[model samples]
Target: MIDEQDEFDEFSEAGEAEMDENKGLYEHVNITVDPKQEPLRIDKFLQNFRQNSSRNKISQTCRAGNVVVNGQIVKQNYRVKPGDQISLLLAHPPRLNVIVPQDIPVNIVYEDDDLVVVDKEPGMVVHPGFGNWDKTLVNALAFHFEKNGSKSDLDRVGLVHRIDKDTSGLLVIAKNEYALSFLAKQFFERKTRRLYWAFVWGNMKEDEGTITGHIGRHPKNRMQMHTYTDGSQGKHAVTHYKVLERFKYMTWVECKLETGRTHQIRAHFKHIGHTLFNDERYEGHTPLRGVNLPKYKQFIKNVFDILPRHALHAHTLGFIHPTTKQDLYFESSMPHDMADAVKKWRNYLEN
Candidate 1:
């Protein structure tokens, strides 16, 4: 649930890495003047694309030499012409909390000058947020950097994408500005590939299918996402899924994200009547499928105890290297708890 947030809050999350144009801040934007673009003031041109951005903020950034056009810092009134490469590095909003280094253990898969790849375990929040102040993945990354004497101003330690606290999986962390910008672009453009493995409550009839809906904050419940099937509201989101295996009343599936909307896979599946197994937030813990006998109910409870959290895992992540331009792929096996629950279901089927 990395991208699950209010629409306005999304801008607060940093995506840009270090670029020659921007002073290496979290707020960065890159735009190329179109061939048919008429000569317009730089600030006005940016305002057209950035509706929430204010002219005063744009002016301040231009004056601070954070607006680069054709490799040169330009004033707010500079005329943007066709074929111009424009980059903006806006100031980061005020920090709410001071990030302190904590000696938390993390499973680092790969590390280099530009970035670090990690295989995150279940129950570890990726970054500090409301009710999650310490012992997060960012705290561990901070400690790792402090121990190595690597000083940086990057916020959230350059996390490009994140999984939910209960979801276990792989993540890529940028160590430098260039890598962050490069990876963020790939994610924003939907070029990176992410695969998740999940066990849902009901047996899916289709071998494979795509779920299309607009995902946004629930009107009544602010914590959850509401899927708009009519394309009337919310941002566009798509999830593609294929059935991998089936139990008596549950199914295992592989999910590929076409768009990284918050709670997209969970919400989209629920829209089609297949809530993820053990997903307490979406009422997946209820006996939505299977027999109504007391023994069957007890078995479901036992399985829930075995897998307390939702039965979902970020199985694999693939992206193009920021520096090398080569394809990079990472995979993590299912966590023990989820695998054990699957085994339990298999045993029940045999019996």
Candidate 2:
């Protein structure tokens, strides 16, 4: 999850259709410079925003006219200005998905003839798409199915819903058409329960609250999401949250998603000005709270190093069984990175 990682990696999965083909080159990133953004060179700006991207690669792309600002090509040294519309095109076209099977391991918590429940680890892509084509959860499932010699009513497996690449948590996959239709309906009808744990910036104005908005792709940046509350854009989404704990500089909360949208929790928290901690795409990585004294600044840096990705996890999932008609719920323990960070925060607070 790089620059657009929250909503960037957060796509409206759950069977959202792929965008039209680029024919040859693909538009990988588009951005709308925030109104308050300070002047910076375009190359440096991109290098900072896109994780793991090298300056030489960015410079080379700029030299090849792959970087565009407001529909005009710009050089690496071109200073980015406020409200600038920037788009980056990858030189190569997207490879078609044959969905090659891989032997990647997945944590299958529950499995039946109808469905499988998996506790997906962080950094695993759910399906084959975009930069990830193979070595996905889907690929692993295919291998598992083939090895077990299981037959399904549907032509292929189905992912009931989707989580971001870097978001660790529970996911249900349909093994047959009946399971697919039944489980998919629950998600669409808002009958399923999806709960997330997130560490966000700032103390809340209240103990708990609901967030409502329409979420859609950012106009200037296709990888990120923007919320419109006037019912003017995207699909309606709702999230209910309650405070579980509070740190000196951050708040710990449990979020129940009433409706699933791409990056629903992350975008909603951002809309309310409590962006997820260490979320690079949403400006949460800049030490947004507390004085940057040597001791405190070092503390922030240590935690960031502990948990490199955004501080969000799909902690719990509940839904009625499609085949048995039994209600089922599963909760995952907090990942080590997050748990360790919380421990450090607790010690810091006590000291």
Listed per candidate, the RMSD to the true structure in angstroms reads 8.0, 17.9
Question: Candidate 1 residues 262-309, lDDT tens each?
Answer: 677788888899999988877898876547544788888899998998
lDDT by residue (160-267, candidate 2, tens digit) is: 677777788888887765565456546644678778899998878789999999888878877567889998888788889999999857999999877666678778
Count clashes in each candidate, considering only residues at least 3 apart in sequence or on different chains: 2, 1
Q: What's the TM for model 1?
A: 0.77
Q: How close is candidate 2 to the true structure, as a TM-score?
A: 0.71
